[model samples]
Target: MWRESSNIGRNQTSSYYVDNTLKHSFSNKTTAKQKSNDLKMPQPDEPYYCSQQIQIPPALPDILKQFTKAAIRTQPKDVLGWSAAYFRALANGETPPVKERLEMPVATQKTDTGLTPGLLRILNKQLGPRKTVDLNIIEEKWKDLALPKEQFDELVRIGGFGGTIEWLRYFALGCSALGENITDAMKTVCEILTADPDGGPSRIPFPLFKDLYTYLAKVDGEISQEHINEVTSHLQYYVDKQEGYVQPRNFTSPDCPKLS
Candidate 1:
């Protein structure tokens, strides 16, 4: 009698456990279904807004037109990235990164880096007026050009630039990095800085050339200041005849003393 009662109790306990488990599982399913229904999209019967309620900004069309024209002229490599830069500049009321005109894609391919003369000219137009520029600002501008971060870092490292850097000095260093040698670098600099028409002899003031040449030579640590002074002194006579203008021809002439 005792054994039979014990077996009956066990069966009852097992049945209760099964029932409780099924009830808990069903409760969870019910709660999950309710939550999912809460998140489900409305059916066709429900409409959030009618088409007549939609509105557009009045200036959007003109803004988009200008943006399209800029994109067409700039010919940016990364449209999405450049677009972000363009919008950010507009929002902040700052100058946007853009090329003045379209250039052959191969203009920068000479150095196999993206630092083309036209791009540099654009950068100059924006940043040249400032004597010293913030490094963070330069990095932002560099990204807008879709230039390699590594190359930017390299220039910064080579210049040993800090929070604020001299713009002309940085510009000179950029020319150095862009060219094969010091002469080539100076030539590029003159071309970029000249007031003469495009494809004409790119001449910069001799005094300005003197300053840049002296600065770059001192930075190089290869040539002595005395040697640099001597070369500039020799060029001064030629510059005198030309009303203080120095061109690549002044340095590359047959009679000109070669720089070591």
Candidate 2:
């Protein structure tokens, strides 16, 4: 009876030990599998897959390079905002808000009205081709530049505009808004239209100046028609001598009637 009891106890202990060993081994394997999953990268055997539908564009590299350079040159205050505008313009086949060159910082306390010569130039390049542009098109371009809606509203009200408008008149109005007075406004227009270098005389074709000036003067409602005729006539002499190019100086000089 003692020998049988000893055998029974030993068998029970052995069975317990075996069960514990198997449980421990299974727990280790489970832990190791979890750790492997945690540490291992997905798809280790094949890092890249060649899919028939996934084709890279050939011009993508150049496009990205240009975008990077534009970002650097533009130095936009709102990265995400400007990027959205840039790509949106690109997709729509409109002029992107890119500066011709990087702008140097100037120390002026004057408030920025969100319109600059460069920005205005971009708008002109975009909308100038058409003699008339729809109000919606103008709004879209304005939004692309991220200009204030209030200013646009003010301009529309100033012109008493409706669905469509003559682009030059609006452009003249834009120049008026840009400058402090009629002369200053005209100067800004000349600068924008001029092919001259920065800080140059900012000469433009006399015919264009006459048209812009005539429109501005008519809107002013203060200048006499005779005075407008007198100014254009005086500038004609210089315009002829200078290969049909009359600069801001021709009319801005004291000899000519004041634009104001």
Q: What's the TM-score of every candidate structure?
A: 0.72, 0.74
lDDT, residue 185, candidate 2? 78
Quote the positional error of residue 166 for candidate 1 in Å. 0.3
Runs in model 2 with CA error above 4 Å? 1-56, 104-111, 197-200
Tell me the number of clashing residue pairs for each predicted model: 0, 0
Task: Please give the lDDT score at residue 167 for candidate 1.
Answer: 87
133 Cα displacement, candidate 1 (Å):
0.9
Model 1 lDDT per residue over 78-160, tens place: 99999998989889887787777787754423467788777787778768888799989888788888988888898888889
- For TM-score, the strongest prediction is 2
Which runs in model 1 stand beyond 4 Å of their true positions? 1-62, 105-111
Worst 10 residues of 2 by lDDT: 103-112
lDDT score of residue 117 within candidate 1? 71
Q: Tens-digit lDDT track for model 2 on 29-115?
A: 999999999998666685665697678899999988988898887666667777888888899897777777776653231346676
**Model 1 Cα shift for residue 111 (angstroms):** 4.2
TM-score of 2: 0.74
What lDDT score is found at residue 210 in candidate 2?
86
